[model samples]
Target: MNLLKRFAVPVACAITALAMTACSSSKDERRTPTPLTQFKPAINVERIWKADVGKAGRYLFSPIAVGDAVFAAGAGGTVAKIDGKTGKVVWRTRLHTDLTAGVGSDGTLTAVGATRGGVYVLDSNGKLLWKSNVAGEVVSPPLIGNGLVVVRTIDGQISAFGAETGELKWVYHNRAEPLNLRVSAGMTFAADAAVLAGFPGGGLAAINLKTGDDYWQAPVSFPKGVTEMERINDVTGAPALVGAETCAVTFQGRVGCFDANTGRPIWQKPFSSTSGVAQDNSTVVAPDDWSVITAFGADDGRQLWRNDKLKNRSLSVPLLFGPSVVLGDYQGYVHFLSRDDGSFVARVKTDGSAITAAPVLAGDTLVVQTSGGDLFGFRPR
Candidate 1:
């Protein structure tokens, strides 16, 4: 949603042996994934339900739709559950700390970071199942995988906790450098059999969700005196598991492809975006400081097309689905483009709000929440 990466946290080391890396775009140089030769409904923006879940005091959280419920955490530690179809609040729970959670079909686990306290497990009906504290400040969302709840904190502490009994399985704390990367935002993006997390200290890291082990990590280092911080802003963009791997964008504005297992950089190139990268099945897209929309092959780091047509306007990350990827601009116009070649599709005006977070898909519905908190939904017209 924002323009950047998180490199401001305090850590004891620059690189640690506690997480893995997922490299994206390493096998090819300039080829898109083979054309899918398939089609689905054209993207029609629709609004299913809208609620003013008042922004959580925490700067990094967003509304998450899991199963049939829409879960949101408020700034004041209020948890609200809304019906996915009705937009009606089903129940609300209050916690001592604001939450970022990893949701699943069974249930969810919420984090309060290391300093604030521990992680909590919540039932779909708004019941608190259990809680276990960790070590630092949590800025990344909790990740649920392999019957374990994985939490990452600002102090470079990663822990694996029992999903049901709130038991501590393992805790791996990495010593970071004096200038550690701050995790103002990140998500547990699942790839292969692992859940990927960590966009810090020059690059990305992947953690084994089951055993609490580090696989591989790629340092996203930059040039001298060109602080990855001053120029880069937030690694707020959660990963999109595109193609055979999971992907993320750094604040420096490049589409990064990781191995999804070892956190190795398969390939990376400067993506010109004031924001970050967005992906459909075939292409990864973004808008630059010049406010241009560009497309790259999802399988390789080759430039496929650049649509300067979206010139000089602020835009959100591209939302990719079947044959179309849509983007909403600061002007409030949502644009639909052909997934095949970035050809001109239709552009529709939204509620005229600045688009921030990447658009999300709910069932057959395209859900876009504006910076002003306006939620718009669409289906094929």
Candidate 2:
């Protein structure tokens, strides 16, 4: 089957919530998210600045922060570089093509992926450098590192391009599953040597930056049920690496920590989540499908605590900052939870749109871009 035909039917149903199951169920049985309660704010959450990029459309495109700047793109084809401290627009340009994911940069070079299977690279000043074609929908921001721009597409293909010349370097495809989430597990650099990515089949592979060769391919989770939906053990979120241990979660499988260099598993725990994992120095935090936030020991994968207050809320990837872990929900509210006990510490409202993308913590300030294209910078007072 062609890529579009293979995904068209399932994607039509699943694209509503990006990772939601489109199974037939009664209206009453549909899990309505919990009503948020009024609580005294424990910490002062202040919005430093706000700006609009454009409409975000269907995909959860996010801004990438590098050093003193934040690069963001909207589905309406607008891309801008914002001043990190002031939220001022440094430079803005229109791609004239619908963007699926973007704003990956290495401070000097910036890149964004189009829904129609291409990548556009820009300089720090927002000038178009080069545009290159790729294989599938670029649902995640390309990873810019080590003179190579790496992109993971929706059809289980990872391709690299020359950062300077826009030449095709290499491509790697993971085992494609018919039933997988429409979202992409954003890629990252591991130990500054390999590009790490998670794919639809609960697989994690590291490709060497220099040679584009596979360093290691490890199974973070596995399929284990009767129906395809039940067996959908896709690694939907980006992997979290802390020191030598790397952790990733799957849709219907396990969350495991592995050795960064070799593909040896250190510890494995059964968990299900579409949102990616987050880590600080002590704990690895993840939100399961029902929006339950759980914290695990960084070294052992031992369950430390679980917070079910945000059940069925469709939380974003957890952000570890200060003494609390922060999460955004379907109703455009950002909730801060105590890292020590999973208690709610602070809550703030965005534009009342779903904050589907994870909050980026740059330095001590927290940056959140809502699905509605409202970019905000928050700091605790």
Candidate 3:
């Protein structure tokens, strides 16, 4: 049997289409990326340091920041903890197998998933604690908290293992869809005891982090199109949580915020994104599939402003910094747009490779990892 027919084409194809807009033979002009316009720099961005991790081979790997250290992994099995301010390697560990997902830590224990269906947990000093097997392919970074290492597999299984012993605690199965995007949709810790995650078919659920039981499940979007390709509506990233509200975005679906406790929709808008949403107390920002960044009112889901200058640039999830909406593009350029007006304020280029993961704010520095495995820390002046 043809594997593509059985598993459906991964959303990576769509990402490739968006990234390779310059090479597309299609006559549609919208497929072309928007040219960067000249803008006066409003803020000075200075590179603090750069470090090389191993490359991410056809997979998305993100670095997690805990306190002053950033834990990062690469597909070639290198996991390292770097100082957030100095960019110096605190400790580096190399696993025996390739890593498919990784770099979750609580400052004491670090967890990552291997390509061969297992989770590896390490102590704060980079010593390998234990490894445990899971049911399916792990692509989302494991959540290490509450004395448990929670992992979500591509087959819709969320398993919690003992953080120290590596013993399985419980497993929660999300309703599987006929076709789902094989992308890195991660889980977030919710309310100290629950794990907030998005599932295939646009579901947002809060699972008990210790027992793997469901607290609440809400729908972010419903599949509507006729074709299987058109009907693929998977929640594409880690849901953003603030106070009692949690927000998520789905592919070919909607962007909505829901009450974290009751799973009731606060407000939803017709939007499609291959990434997640970032929000502050007042504004929620996300990039649509074409890389048009839009900001919405966090309280009522009203459209505030939009900047489409980076369309078809394959933007990552927006990082809401102090006064700017920060994001990276396919060309490895990190952009800072004014949060109030969506205007470009500053831009900096990397090693000319795609930055698939969101730019993380480590301490006061902005950290970004490119697909080519270069991690750079920047500070605003």
Candidate 4:
């Protein structure tokens, strides 16, 4: 796909991040570090392919790759699937009410939580599998394991259902003070069992995928404070397992990694400590809270290097694009920096809108969604 470069393009997009901000954890202990103040220097980026598909999933809630195609949802319950390489919509459907981008077993199947408190499914070719009303407005994406389906509502309720029959399994209540956790659910690693669904008040519980039984339970995080923001945390995004360490982000602006077996804190940093970290074969790389990309020893959370060139409003979970660590800023720009020294290498001037969502790395195409509903997929020029 040949493309044109649109630098400083005057696009009417809201970088305010109100939509993205709402998806963030309610607790922000310290101000987020600005990327400009870091010690790194300028990097280079080139434009590849830019098109207006008019669908953006928003920050932590967005467009994702499910096998060969990427799925994005819009305001009017509009869901579209784009060819991973051609930026073409292979399938588009309007589900009446607004729906969230789905996540499930493989990229082949999609399960989305709708604002109207419904759970919907789609097959690999973008065909509707089923739609069932669970009980509450589905906020968190559904979890699949052990032949059971788990989902949570915006108000912090967890419901387990039979994945095959869509039959109600069991329901659990998570009564957390609603200070403003834009999201309401989370999950952690369970040995050979199912994914543990994390709730509020530091409630850590796991539902057996086979029988929906409460396997093991623990707290997501221990909060200590007198203020409203201090006491609340909304878990967003799927938890990343760093080897034996299980990592998760809370709405309170805290990143914690715990022992997958013991539920102990392996390492913890604030949202400002290192908002997002991406793991590879060898490195535990994280975006510094202030203005740097730091690689830590995954074995013990030891800091290796601080590449200051990759800082921004909200540090996204960096995607390894080619030999570069790809991170998008709040200004809607895609940056490809050297993974070793954090040196700026290539930068592609995107729509200049805040790219709150993580970039999708397909077989070859680089897919990202901006705040203004523009789906941009790029390739090396």
Instruction: Kindly give the number of clashing pairs for every candidate.
Output: 51, 0, 0, 13
lDDT for each residue of candidate 4 in 1-381, tens digit (9 for 90 to 100): 001121111000111223334224355533343444332434434344555545445423556675557777654466667777777777776676676534443455566677667887676666777677866556555765555567777555677766666788777666645453444244433433545555544445544555555655555556667875566554444555544555555544555555554566666655422234565445556564343566665556666667755443565557766678787776776777776766776666577676755677655778887766777877775
Local error of candidate 4 at 132, Å? 1.9
Model 2 C-alpha lDDT per residue in residues 1-381, reported as the tens digit of each score: 011111110001123334363122224355567678777778999999998888678888777787768888899888988887888999999988899887788888889998678899998688889998887778888888788888888866888899998999888878767777777578767644777788887998877777778888999988998987777777876777766667888988888888766878988899988788987557889988878899999889889999988878888988888788998987789999999989888999989987877888655668888889888889999
Q: How displaced is residue 110 in candidate 4, in Å?
A: 2.3
Candidate 3 lDDT (Cα, 0 to 1): 0.84
> Candidate 1: misplaced stretches above 4 Å?
1-44, 96-118, 174-184, 189-192, 220-223, 226-236, 261-264, 272-275, 289-291, 308-315, 328-337, 340-355, 370-376
Clashing pairs in 3: none
Q: Every model's Cα RMSD, please?
A: 10.3, 6.6, 6.9, 9.0
Write the residue-wise lDDT of candidate 1 on 243-304 in tens digits: 44556665444566765555567678865333456655556676664556677776786888
TM-score of 2: 0.93
Report lDDT (Cα) of residue 58, candidate 1. 25
How many backbone collisions does model 4 have?
13
Q: Please, what are the lDDT tens digits per residue for candidate 3 over residues 267-378?
A: 9999988777897668889998888999999899999999989988888888999999999987899999999899999999999898888888789989999999999999
Model 4: residues with Cα > 4 Å off, grouped in runs:
1-60, 100-107, 144-149, 183-192, 196-206, 213-215, 218-220, 242-244, 251-254, 269-276, 287-293, 307-312
What is the lDDT, from 0 to 100, of the residue 257 in candidate 1?
71
Candidate 3 lDDT trough over 10 residues, lowest sum = 2-11
